[model samples]
Target: MTIPTLEDSGQGTGTAGEARRLAVRGDLTMAHVGAIAGPLRAIPPAGHDLAIDLSGIDRIDTAGAWLIHRMVQDWGAAGVPARVENASPDADRLIAEVAANDRPVPCHVPRGNSALDQLVRIGNAVFVITENIGKILAFLGQTLIVLAQTLVGRRPLRWHAVIHQCEAIGVNALAIVGLLLFLVGIVVAQQGAVQLRQFGAEVFVVNLIGRGTFRELGLLLTAIMVAGRSASAFAAQIGSMKLNQEVDALETIGMSPIEVLVIPRVIAMAIMLLLLGFYGSVMAVIGGGLFCWVSLGIPPVSFIQRLQEATPLSDLVIGLVKAPVFGFIVALMGCYQGMQVTGNAESVGQRTTQAVVESIFIVIVLDAFFAVFFSALGYN
Candidate 1:
């Protein structure tokens, strides 16, 4: 029985009959093995002259050659003589010698799609995002309800947890923040003094630092540190719980993991960020004042006077206002990434890193948004 001719319409220098040429191109890895198989096995049985051009082939492995061999077999089975051409020296020798008896293998067939497939793909994506958004909103609402309940529930604040978190978030962080803020204040004050001195307005350095620190620096610095410190901690803790399936166990036991695990930590972070902002403002002013007095020869009383005159109460309030929002975003990102963690210890570490990076990024973005918003509202 004569096997039907397999049509070949791939790119070559000439038309189909003008010296038939078969080209194999693209990755030689398993990814394209099946794609190559199709054209190769479809060679016409009436082939007068055929050349398996490996010209476009860049890299090749055993799998690639096996694919090519299958095509050659089909040509031979069709009683059409075919010779491999343009083969790399290595590939040519290998194909002619080793894989000469290479038999045709069945190509992998991809799962077919039906009408339901289109619906499923679209519906699943829409459903997942909707569900996730709902979860996030519910999480926020439930957290707020829990916070309100705690305030009125007549249960004394969990001073122990609060104190523990304070020590970890505030006390343990004090030295690093103090040192950094001190240096930052000095740098900012000195820089401002230099420009002000040019205009004989050096005393304004005090006002600059005072207003800038309380209105922005204190909050920004505190949020950044917490994003790095506390957000990372949340991710690590929750990721560890996830790794151990503790979150699952909590869910199974009828506990709202968001309530039990997430809310308290978020609340603690918010409180700690507020305190840190206050502390940083004080420290930045002190350091900035010292820099102005000693380095710029401005008197302490004069510096304080200028600062009080230049900085407004609104600046202080604005800075404090941002703390809870920032804390909320940081904590939420940490918990979200932690919940997404899978795999192993490596995944935990990776998720922790991602959580901190994402938290910091989100913080900066929100800070910018607030800056522009407040500017428009005439609050800054």
Candidate 2:
């Protein structure tokens, strides 16, 4: 095949104006583009009409078509009439594609007013939050329906899966949960003692540790830790299943993915969170009692006695009630985000991170609501 060449014929008057004709010959593919591109673009000032002849092109590809399209656009923008002529069907289609895609990208320009920009951002955030709330509520409704069906014996519960999840979420987390709460308890007791010592009321440190652990710190911290650990795991596990089409496989076999995968996890999280919260509270109390005995000269027995007298049964009840609700929220966020995953591994990772962050945020928000609610009810 001959190398591509661009030949400029002498100018002549046409219907529009004086016109310069450029003839492109031979195969107009990537291999020949470098040979002809410079000469084609080196034409005199763009005052005259220009016509590019492609009829002599034996072969053409996207690269050559783009070059021709660019030259036409450059001259056209400079007040010269420019167009491709005598192009074969394939060449015309390629050039048309190149021309169609040669559009300027839109750029974002910042508004001058900072307050208006802030308001716009706030509105967008509110819109996104409202949409996500609706989705989570819908998912909650579906989960409750499936759970009710299992309770009524209409659908079988997978006991083995539930047990496995319980072990993973609760039993495996015992060491970390116990250790962290113990440290928190020591901090609370030491701080309380320091403040109360000035007033000669150091013994009241027992009240601080006992009421705080039983009512707030114990369950709240447990839920946050579980959200970080188990919520991410649930999202990753189910998201991987989604990526591999295993969730689709279950549906194709007439199995509900919610029933087979989600119900057991939700049940296990609720049950384990309740138990873990109680265990963490006990560990915290132990640490507080140890601190009192060593630092304040308050014996373990006196510490136990003061704690029993100071902390109400209502405080324990409040913590217990909130544990399962927090657990359900964490599990729901994880499973819902997992089901929403599509496309590839990146989606799984993104959903997993979203599940963890959202779980923790929602848990803290609910914890605040519970605090206000119990306080109004005289539980404080």
Candidate 3:
């Protein structure tokens, strides 16, 4: 077989100067295409049209055709018209196919009006947010339907999965939740005592601790912790299952992925957050009481008496009422983001981060709304 070679045909000097020509000789297969590719691309733009002669090619393949098509495209892009000439039927067909498959990269042109561009970007962002909110609402409806079915005995509750998730979400998280709330309680008591001591009312620090812990800190902080820990875990687990097509496999076996996967997680989060929230409140109160005993010289008994008198049943009720709702929001956002994952590992990571962020944001927003609502009802 002849070795592949690219030879430059001398430029014509006629009145109408002919285009420069590059003739490719020998087998233009994968094995030889690489050798000739460099020289072909090195041909200078002599301020004339360009022609690639392929008739001298002993054999040709897709690789060679691609090389020829790329050379023509490169020259054309440089304002030098280029074409293939004297190609055999097979070579011509292959080159044509390669050329047809070459797609130009899109160029982004800046708009003249900066304000208009900004407005367009803002509109697109708003559209994406609205679309995502719609999707989340639809997911919420589907989950509710599945939950209702389970409640009515139409769908079987997966007790095993629920128990597993409860252990993972609540039991495993107990230490961190208790520690954080305890520290926060001590800080709040110290700060409150400092302020109240100015007016010789340092004893009222108990009221600050009790009311704050039961009404807001305990449940709100616990929910945020759970959102960071359990929400990200849920998104990662479900997203991985999706990437592996295990979700599809369940569907193939006539199992509803939502019923099997989502319901158990949601139920477990609701149940466990209730318990965790109460436990966290007790821990915070204990920390505050300890701080008062050591720093403010208020004995435990005195602190307890003041706490009872100052923190009402209404405050406790408000916190408990918010727990399960916050839990549901966390679980729903995680699962929704998980279900949205597609493509690859990067997508799973993105969804997991989104789940954590969205869960915490929604939880805080709802907490604010609940605070306003209860205040209107005279719970403050």
Best of the candidates, TM-score: 3
- For each of the candidates, the C-alpha root-mean-square deviation to the true structure, in angstroms, is 12.2, 5.8, 6.0
| Candidate ordering by TM-score (highest first) | 3, 2, 1
Q: What TM-score does model 1 achieve against the real structure?
A: 0.64
The TM-score of candidate 3 is 0.74
Candidate 2 local lDDT, residue 270? 96
TM-score of each: 0.64, 0.72, 0.74
Question: Stretches of candidate 2 above 4 Å error?
Answer: 1-120
The collision pairs in model 3 are none
lDDT of 1 by residue, 148-209 (tens): 76778733355566567667777888887787778888888988988898999887788889
**Which segments of candidate 3 are over 4 A away from where they belong?**
1-111
User: Model-by-model lDDT, in order?
Assistant: 0.78, 0.92, 0.92
Candidate 2's TM-score reads 0.72
Query: What are the per-residue Cα lDDT tens digits for candidate 3 across 5-99?
Result: 87887664433558777888999999878898888767766556888888788999999889888888888888878889999888888888888
